[model samples]
Target: MPLSEQEQRLLDEMERHLLHNDADVVSAPSGDRTLSYRNLVYGALLLLAGVGALVAGVILGDVWGIVVGVIGFAAMLAGVMFAVTPVRRATPVTPREATSAKRQDSASFMDRMNDRWDRRQDGR
Candidate 1:
């Protein structure tokens, strides 16, 4: 079932207002939240481990320690990249746009049918 033009416009307007309100709420930053002390301590431990690997590699002339250090560094870089990327949202289609798209689709379908009919006639 298709919506009438006026109903579609009302829906679109309501959607825009809701998105605007949501944008305002999300943009305000509250700074009361504190980082977990345990997590911070664990992060420091990981940093120390990386430094230890590098120092041990240089002191003992072991190439495998260097490889371990490189792998840890790569993992950290990948985590940062994943955190910064934004999630994409789907755009809502209005009734007018939907109708236009349907018309175009039907036009192409009719064209294909006409071509098939012409081919059948030629063959017969």
Candidate 2:
């Protein structure tokens, strides 16, 4: 059955309240995890170049080549990391989830203090 008018109104009010209170959470990026194909290809090419440079440096025992190889390796790492990194993760957050967590933390803290007070009162 559909929600009653009062229920609907309550829900709408709750939504507005949640949005107002947790506007930052709602606007925060949720990590879109799509990879850019172009970037991935470029990353792969860079990795390959780095590997080749490192191998050539090791085989020839050239210090400058080794330095260049390390730089290439760094570039490859950057490219690969950029390609793999998520733009944003899609997170569907509700006010209840946020508040519930906070409430739980606060409740735990209060419970601990209350328990201590009770123990002291009971002299045990």
Best by lDDT: 2
Tens digits of lDDT, candidate 1, 3-122? 999778656654544444464563332333333445455556665665666566566556786776675565455444444434333443343654554454555555755897999999
Candidate 2 C-alpha lDDT tens digits along 61-120: 678877877877787687678667545335544656666555445554557658979999
lDDT of 2: 0.66
Clashing pairs in 2: 30-88, 30-89, 30-90, 31-88, 31-89, 32-88, 32-89
Winning model by TM-score: 2
What's the lDDT for all of these models?
0.55, 0.66
List the lowest-lDDT window of 10 residues for candidate 1. Answer: 26-35
Which regions in candidate 1 have their CA more than 4 angstroms from the true location? 1-33, 71-124
Clashes of each: 0, 7
| Candidate 2 ranges beyond 4 A from true positions | 1-30, 88-124
TM-score, per-candidate, Cα-based: 0.30, 0.40
